[model samples]
Target: MKLLLVEDDSDYAATLSRALEAMGHDVVVARDGVAAIEFNDRDQFDAIILDRMLPQMDGTTLVERLRERGQTLPVLMLSALGQSIDKVDGLKAGADDYVVKPTSVGEIDARLHALVRARGWKGEGATTLRAGAILVNPGKHRAWYGDDALDLSNLEFKLLAELTRHAGSFVTRTMLLERVWGYDFEPATNIIEVQIRALRRKLTASGSPDPIVTKRGVGYMLEA
Candidate 1:
């Protein structure tokens, strides 16, 4: 994921950037709220880690401005002010999530991921999807492989629905993480592979040919 880190403290920004980069995200630093808004205008990013207080525009004001301009990107506001009123102000101004200062970096990462997940399928407008032998009805929370009804867990259903949308195109691990789990980067676990194996088993349980194709060093594609 590409992230915008808005922090006036150069040292804190550097450390946070390094940590997020190590998590497989691309980080762009904006030292002030005005600069952050400028960066937003120039390019798209997955999310923003914004500081509550800054030189020019404060984080809450920045969030309000962004919302006024119809920007729906997720934002995580960090503040030394841990008062309930401070957090309420951030959310009312349209920050997706707020964290008090000195919070664990892992907690911050988790909150960012949660925010993205909450908005995951908003832009896609996905409905029932089909690819060759597979059919997935997201609204119905159901799927079928050529008349063989599939009983899938929530995760499996989401994974299959994503693959069915692409049909013949390769869906990379990173893409699956973002779309299915709202994760911006590949996790340390073999979650994608594990889900793929489960989905394959169900798709082939009725003696149909395996429709999922795996490419070495690439990704997975569902045959059409």
Candidate 2:
């Protein structure tokens, strides 16, 4: 997945970028809100990670601007202020998810993954899905491949549910970010790829064929 990370802290950005790359994701970094907004206007990204306090324009204002332009990209906001009031303010300003600063990259990745999956549920009302040998129970939040139960994390379960719900349909990276991760702003991060890899590992471990079909330059689809 291609992600945009908007952060003014060079050291933190560098460290996070390296971690995401190590997990097989493509990351684009923007130093401040101005560059972040410019990047959003010019290029498409799967997801975005934004810092609450930024130069040029604050994260809240940037999100408001994007909303006005009718852009529905997923955004995860980061801040040092972890107060509930602050989180509410961010959400009211159009953020999908909010996290305090000094958060682990792993947790950020998980939250982003969840946001994407949430965005992918399109109310198809499909209760069950079969891909290869894998069986998904949407209502029960469980999956199995043959006799082996597939152990999934909360984020992983949501991811599978989304893919299965939209089985055979191409799910855009942006869509995944919006619904699954609940992000209303775009960030520069490679969270989608990271989560997919983890999900794949779990699926494959259950003796199932890879059910996820990747469309280069587009997004992902679950094989019908």
Predicted candidate 2 versus true structure: per-residue lDDT over 160-212, tens digit per residue: 87887687899988888888898877669888888999998987874668879
Give lDDT for model 1.
0.84
C-alpha local distance difference test of each model? 0.84, 0.78
**Model 1 spans with C-alpha error above 4 angstroms:** 121-224
Candidate 2 residue 50 Cα shift, in angstroms, is 0.4
Task: Show model 2 residue runs off by greater than 4 Å.
Answer: 121-224
In candidate 1, where is summed lDDT lowest over 10 consecutive residues?
Answer: 121-130
TM-score of 1: 0.54
| Residue pairs clashing, model 1 | none
Give per-residue lDDT, candidate 1, residue 132. Answer: 61
Per-model TM-score versus the true fold: 0.54, 0.53
